[model samples]
Target: MLVLGIDTSCDDTSVSVYDAKENRVLSNIVSSQYSFHREFGGVVPEIAARKHAENIDLVFEEALEVAGVGVKDLNLISVTNRPGLLPALLVGLTFGKGLAYSLSVPFKAVHHIEAHIFSPFIGSEPEYPFIALVVSGGHTLIVLVEGFGSYSLLGKTLDDAVGEAYDKVAKLLGLGYPGGPVIDRLYREYDGKYLELPKPKVKGFNYSFSGIKTAVRRLVEKGYPAEQVAASFQETAVSYLIGKLKKALKETGVRRVAVSGGVSANSLLRERLKELDVDLYLPPLEYTSDNGAMVAYVGYRRFLIEGEDTLEVGALARCPIS
Candidate 1:
């Protein structure tokens, strides 16, 4: 089956063509609006939505062209319609619905987080009953994946998501927007002593990064070296995440683990996870962030199990996966 996937969940306008029959992605295209939101030090919802609206069509066309397919050849239309910026979600959802209606193909609405959970298995089948750590700008969650479309919410962030904390800390250090990459780079470059940061004492599997963010703010105010601050923050944050994951592994006794989302692209996190004594799955860098390939892949899986949705389905700004 040929599935066209569209995802405008946040600052990225991504589209992909997945060949389900062949179990492969034909074309996965993501047009990021980082330049537009950089000046603001973070994503502005209105700007993100506007950029999605302007870029979705062009991205769609490019995806099809790269995939060597036409609209008439598509058998399914999958789109991210929930748990994202409302305006951005609507742009992709509306366009997807219209295209589905025109082509008389099935329209599938996918949950953004659920797509992230299975992103690592885009071209392969995922093992059942695995633990998933999904970290992104808008969400940070640890979920138990029983099977396709079957998820158990193990834990999530009580305050800012990890990526949000990274951005906020970067802003405090006068670093540019989309803090993860720059901060990660700085963390790798710095050789001096690192600033000490506090790890949150949240019980269970839940996480809290607000305290650490504040710690970074105080250090910056004390005129600490920006590189050391960034390095320290990255180390502390990644360690905190690993600590929680280790606890989850002990509690659930699930040795198969998968990590996904934008924050999963962190080099430090990847290195830490690789050291764990368990089967680990991490998405390719291109699929680490918001993208249409994962959305399409999950949509294909859902369609096989639950069929399609009606036109009455609408976009949602907040929705739980389980």
Candidate 2:
């Protein structure tokens, strides 16, 4: 089946078409609005949603053109439905719903975070029963995915997500918007010992980054070098993530693990997770961050597994397979 995926979860206006039969990304296009939102320090929901509305059609057309497919060729329609700016979510959903209805295709409402966890399996299908560490601007969650449509929420963050930490620290260092990558670059130049940052003591699979944020803020207040503080912040963030992944691996007993989200593109996290010696799965640089390809892949796969039947689907801000 050919599936079309739409993702307007945040600042990026993304669309992709997947060919499940061939098992590959026929087309994946992401139009980032970072430049528009940069002045705001981060994504402004209203601004982001409005931008999506303006560009959604163009991005949608581009995806189809790149895929070399027409709407009539698609058998399924998928859109991220959740845990995002409601208006942004609606932008994609409304368009997707209309497209599905017009084409007489099946509509699959996907959870934004779940689509992130499902990212690694795009193109080449990975084995099931793996651990998923989803770190993004708004969320951080470690989940146990038994299979498509089946998952358990093992743990999450109490305050800021890893991406949020990156953005905040980037702002402190005068780095522009979408700070994760920029700060990661700075981390290589400076040592993070301007002040010993503390990792939050989270219980079980749960996590907390608020304390570290406060620590960084205080360091900035004390007049530490911006680069050093940025470096230190990056170090602690990567260390904490790996530490948590190890904990989840040991506790969940899932030797296969996957990491997703905009922050997953961080080289440090990628390198650190490699040391675990597990069947580690990560999205290619292209797939990392918010995009529609993962959603299309997820929907297409589920449709294949279920033989074209229907199930309950909705735009859920908090839909956990668990």
Candidate 3:
């Protein structure tokens, strides 16, 4: 069955078509509003919401065009409905509802984080009973996935997310807008061993980046080399992430591991995680962020795993897939 997914969880407006039986993405399109929010140093809710209201149609149209199918051809309609910026979410929900009603198809509301956990299956087959680390701009979470839509939270941030840490450090160093990639590139120029950044010694499957964020600032002001400081900052941040991730794996006893969200797009993170010698999955470069394709794919799997949901499914600004 064909499921159409719509996503406007934050700065990107995206649409995707997925085939439940085949477990594949027929077409996925994303319209990014990064440039509009770049100068502001972060996303502005009002501007992002307004842009999503305008771009949803164009993004959906492109999805159909790329998939070689129209709205009428879809068997189910789905949109992200929770755990996102409220203003950004309403646009996708409103558009998705209208399309579902007009086409008389079942409408499903999927959680944003759930969609991220399921994103790896966008192009490949899925593996069950694994650990999924969801690291993005606003969230950092570890989930022990037992099956489709069946997961238990293993760990999460006590304060700022990993992505936010990267961004903050980047801004301090005069780097570009999404901080992780730039910090990573600049890290190659410095020695990570130089700075003695604090590592949040949180015990057992929990994470804390608040101290690291503060420590980086103090180190920079104390005459640390710019390049080495950048390198140490990234290393410490990733070290904390990897530390908790490994802890989650041990606690859950699941070697099959995967990660998703905008920060997962980082080259260094991917490289580090790949060395684990476990069955691992990462989204295609396009699926690493908030894209409609992941939503559609999640919707497709949901319908099959839990059966078809009524079009009366409620819209939520916060929801739990489990």
| Candidate whose lDDT is highest | 1
Residue-wise lDDT of candidate 2 within 270-301, one digit each (tens)?
98999997999999988889889998887676
| TM-score, model 1 to reference | 0.99
Candidate 3, residues 12-123: lDDT per residue as tens digits? 9999888777877898888999789878777889999999998888888989999998778999988988877889988998899888889888888888998898787776
lDDT tens string, model 1, 23-112? 999999999999999999999999999999999999999999999998899999999999999988999999999999999999999999
Order of candidate numbers by lDDT, starting with the best: 1, 2, 3
- TM-score to true structure, per model: 0.99, 0.94, 0.93
Better of 1 and 2 by lDDT: 1
lDDT of 2 at 75: 86
The most accurate candidate by TM-score is 1
Instruction: Give the root-mean-square deviation of each candidate in angstroms.
Output: 0.7, 2.1, 1.9
Where model 3 places Cα greater than 4 Å from the true spot, the runs are 189-193, 223-225, 307-315, 320-322
Q: What residue pairs clash in candidate 3, if any at all?
A: none
